[model samples]
Target: MITAPGGRTLDLANLRCVFTLQGWTTSQWGSAVFKIYNLSDDTANAIQAGEFSSIQLIAGYQNNSGILFDGKIRYSSRSLENKTDQVVTIQAVDSHDAKVYATINQTLGKGYDAARVDAALMQTFEPYGVTRGRTAKMPGTKYPRSKAMFGRSTVYQDLLAKQCRFLWQFINGQYVSIFEDASLDDVIVLNGRTGLLGVPTQTIGGGAVIRCLINPTIQWRSLVQVELQSATTGYFIVNSINCQGDTMGDDWYMDLNCTAHNNLVDKPHKDSSKN
Candidate 1:
């Protein structure tokens, strides 16, 4: 679903979307590209004129569907494909992407602890539509003297995350901080019955790369349970996910790059199990 300016909503028929997610690296801000076909001239013009500000892509069954991508549109272009099909392409970044290059100049008085510093940071980002989400416990470090902060917000966030040994990123307009190996409590079981598409392969970094039917429940930092014959069966943390969907084509799927949650890598399971 794409929301143009003035609160007008649009439901496109011919659509293709790609949404990618990586860990807390500033360079890896969640991004999405949307291609819509045969849009009304007015709508296309609005999008091209920078009036379309946000988009929401949802997937899955009626009762199980959830938001797959919610982001801010950054650019849009209109083109004629084959001289008949009108195609409008929109490029967007995560809501927090603005903060990646946003400069901040602030000072914290002496005795400000990590929690206070985090609160200040959140306050700074509120104007950009960012809100606080789940965050890892920060170190109880307190400043002995006034702390002056300057330069890009991403830089300061990176420094803070490194000091706390946590990974920080914006997910769905909310700031999230979590340990590198930490997994969410809710586990999504994957198997033949649960939309696991093909055999999961091992990446060079000892992680697993999997393809499955579009599952909205799969997101960054999610815990996935793999039950398959050729892959190691255990819990894995979703480090990256690439979601692709086409309303008029056979292209709905998700590619996930996952790391073993506990480094559990026993021999491949010999029996086929249904979960």
Candidate 2:
């Protein structure tokens, strides 16, 4: 079961839910989508429409020892199957996106590396509870540049990370440390012990795709090792994730779509004049 955050203070016994989450590091992959389903409560009304709220979801499989997806809920929806069954659907951008947009105005000085730029962005985000590990490689000597803040933090962070060979995202409302390439090492070892659900199959992303039981331990950009005794046994970076489960019934799993360490997407080039 996954924990849902809201004003109502929900418990496992009182909720029913399912969700598919998509997270990304490259521009082509786009924003995170957390499509959530929930039964309408007789009293609480958790899925009301308004930009005044955010949700933190901690998802995992039946044992509750893993992290399927860890992030925020920024958008939502609802529908009816007759009057007795209702599913509240929610669409959320990654917390990193929300943080960048919510961060009103700030300016990074004329000279700073990508790592330093991330530090400045974190200043605006520290209060929101960020999650991340150590620095990956902040390669490229594009150490000094002039960037003035005209709008959202997303605009600025994207430009800086790309030029310096890095990318960032927010996990469960906190920032996961930016990395040049996250799949090079294995952070989570996946096999029969950790719910290895399939062998490598050809998927849309060109790299091999694997799905496993859901848990809250793995976050976007974290490394995972698939130790199956085949061509699939190797390290990979988490490209995307989908956390699906229902608390009202006995069904749940987390799907991880990853890119090999050597295949992480490149950040797009930004026109310096545009910034």
Highest lDDT, which number?
A: 1
> Model 2, which residues run further than 4 Å from truth?
1-8, 12-14, 27-46, 49-52, 61-78, 96-116, 125-147, 183-186, 204-206, 229-232, 248-251, 261-275
Model 1 Cα shift for residue 53 (angstroms) = 1.6
Overall lDDT per candidate, in order of appearance: 0.72, 0.54
Give TM-scores for every candidate, taking all chains together and pairing residue i with residue i: 0.86, 0.68
Error of 1 at 197 (Å): 1.3
Model 1 segments more than 4 A misplaced:
13-27, 230-232, 262-275
In model 2, what is the error at residue 198, expressed in angstroms?
Answer: 2.3
| Model 1 agreement with the true structure over 1-275: per-residue lDDT tens digits | 77865788777634544344333333256878777888889888977887778887777776688877778888888888777888888887777554665667899899988777667777777778787877777667787998888887777777777776777777777777776556666778899899899888877777888889888888777778888866557767778787777776787788888776446443222211111
Minimum summed lDDT over a 10-residue window in model 1 is located at 266-275
Per-residue lDDT for 1-275 in model 2, tens only? 22344444443344655555565545322233433344436422544535324444555545655433444555556677456666666555545445644463656566655556666765665555554434444543454666555566566667766776665555445444444553323367788777778675556756556677766677565567777765345666666666566655555655667766444224222212100
